[model samples]
Target: MNEDAQAALGILAQQIRMAGNNPDQPNRVGNANPALSSLRNPVYGTTSLTLAGTNTTSQLSMRGCDGTFTNINSTNTTTTGIDALTCVAGGTNTVPDSIAVSYEADRFNTIPTGGTSSLPTDCLGNKLPVVTATVSTIVAGTASSADVTYTVADNRYYIGTASVANVVTPSLYCKGNGGASVQMPMVENIETLQLRYGTVSTASTATTATVAGYLHATEVLTETSMALLANDAERWAKVATVRICVLVRSENPVAPNAASAQYTDCAGNLVDNPPDLRLRRAYTTTVVLRNRRL
Candidate 1:
């Protein structure tokens, strides 16, 4: 092969390797599989909140995605009755088990209900402070001093934080007709980036979860929506495996005169080549959440 042609092939190989073998950590550390390592830990928070009835107003202060505490109100609502727990004039109380509430990290801050000296205490007796609440709903009970388990919705933690590193986005290089060869800032290249979720119904009975089929990121919409998908806990807890595919193309025309090729892209879309010399390829990998599985 000519020197130019050989060099072009080398470049294509390098790009593919970079896409497949790039460090999954946001800081670009270690040789972890980008497919699985990127999604190592799903962002979520779980805490318990005790309710107080006398005030007809209660708050649960929970940590946000950014590690800040946000207040969640457990105010008595007309629709959801709060008669399960008895609020004594002066006595300790716990939140009822029936009142299940899940919180979203983003929608945490609602109007400030002011500070409460009578805030709910966790199992360890640590007094949790009240901050603010954007969204709060009392699902079942109306007890004055009942214990409520507050789960901050599960979110994609692969995006990384200021201190921690994670890998969720993949990037690639490509050249358009008139534009110089450039790297697409986002999960780039020729076609779609597809993901499939594997969910298990029973953790003990089954060894592997059932594949729920491919889906777009928008399907889950928000962390709250994700919590409600399929079974309440399936979205994150039962997510055993994730399949990722990236369909990409060469930045330069390596296969000139190659007849208009027909191919299937990542999102399972068929495409007819644009009669260009660019070479295209698809890379796929399956990532299992070992922690979730165990």
Candidate 2:
């Protein structure tokens, strides 16, 4: 269970670190172009994912960086978080026990035609398409090819969870060239999954260099909450880290009079005597946004 939780965290954290700048704010940090991209809320936190009497659940969606991106496809019709190309989970689209979310990522390979890995791939080592288009630019009376030919395609990941028999499993949706979402079941017996955004408040949303401290997504100052210069999108850009916490159940039941009914949850709250008799453990990770920090 611990291993499974850790593995899931790694996958989520890696994408968070590679998150691109929100395209809504023109003066946001990161070199990603705001024109081609319509991302405003790089890290968009949707409503809580409530399971059957489960406490640990939250829906989070983010935009993957392109330095060079677009709105992803969704089954929902809600326009919430449109700036960031995010949609709230609703309209019979499943929630709590299960939900659908689009995981932002770059589907193309940018190896400049020569790299150790002979093929492009998704999160799993599956073969994928590569960018083969190039642009010609002349500088100093010399013509040079901007070899971005290897950086074209973008992937749309549609993530969700499912319950089979009695065990619940979380799956990762990998989008392919033909625009097909492949469902990859990640781990099993995951009881709860929660995520909290780490954001910083600045005097002006237009600029942010060093973050003082990370605050809760709601606690963070915004023009709507504090009437400060800090806007919604800018505050999201100030997010430097993401905290992921997951709880998994043991496969086999504990021996008689051996298992502890109480366990600590991802929120640091003491969950006294859970309903089930199976052993459970919580795993957590705080991932740094490498692209944002840089």
Candidate 3:
């Protein structure tokens, strides 16, 4: 080959090596691209793990989902009681034992306006104004023992119950009911989810509290996270109180090299580290509690 042609081949080989792409090697293992396989369920997020070995029989211990377990049998390519999730394999099938937690929902709809559909007034009617049975009109404050006299802004007048059970702060996706059902896909392959309860002071500060039965890093979210958050959210909404905020964090550390190789030191010097991972997109929502009793 001519010198120019040889030099061109050398550059091409270098580029191929950088990409980890091998064309001629036989039985190569590392050249395959990594892949993400997910399982889906009606309960909220992905919840199951399955893999296939060269053998016809394979078993995977299902974890997560309110701390439950089942064995997956791949020999038949069928799973027992594992729903809403599918096992996928590709890219030399180099699957990681752990995956980053991912929560995704379809496009969100704008909060509705007008009448009770609006905020301050919960959509669940947990805060419907109560009418007093007293002879004269009376206004009840948070401390007032007697029922408060109030007129309904709308046609419906609901009787006063002790309080309404708050549903979990619903992560509502525009299901295209206005059009089509929005698809919500979630995965918890990371360390798990951690929920921190904070008190919203008049100063607008969120003071974190160590709440028992709260979310933790080691806990796979499944239904528990959704359940606990809903309970706290209901209590928060029923009281007719100040705006409250909940802090949600993924226990899963951002994968190393998940971000770009660039880093800024304490002094703001940019340094490049080529061996870093990039951060992937994730989903989480914060619900605010407003409307307080005076």
lDDT by residue for model 3 (22-53), tens: 12212212213211111111111112222122
Candidate 2, 1-294: lDDT as tens digits: 767777767666665565552223332222254322222322233122111221111123333221101234432212322343433332121111121223232334222223565554444344434333223344576655443222112334433457678865444433332223343555566666555556555543435545555443334333343345445445555666666666776766673543376778766777776766777777888887665622
Better of 1 and 3 by lDDT: 1
Q: Pick the candidate with the highest TM-score.
A: 2
Query: Cα miss at 72, model 1 (Å)?
Result: 24
* Model 3 quality (TM-score): 0.18
Candidate 1 structure lDDT: 0.30
Instruction: State every prediction's TM-score relative to the real structure.
Output: 0.34, 0.57, 0.18
Overall lDDT per candidate, in order of appearance: 0.30, 0.44, 0.21
Considering TM-score, where higher is better, how would the candidates rank from best to worst?
2, 1, 3
- Candidate 2 similarity to native, TM-score: 0.57
Q: Which segments of model 3 are wrong by more than 4 Å?
A: 1-180, 184-195, 199-234, 238-276, 280-288, 292-294
Model 1 has a clash total of 17
lDDT of 1 by residue, 109-135 (tens): 212223552333221122333223122
Model 2 has how many clashing residue pairs?
A: 2
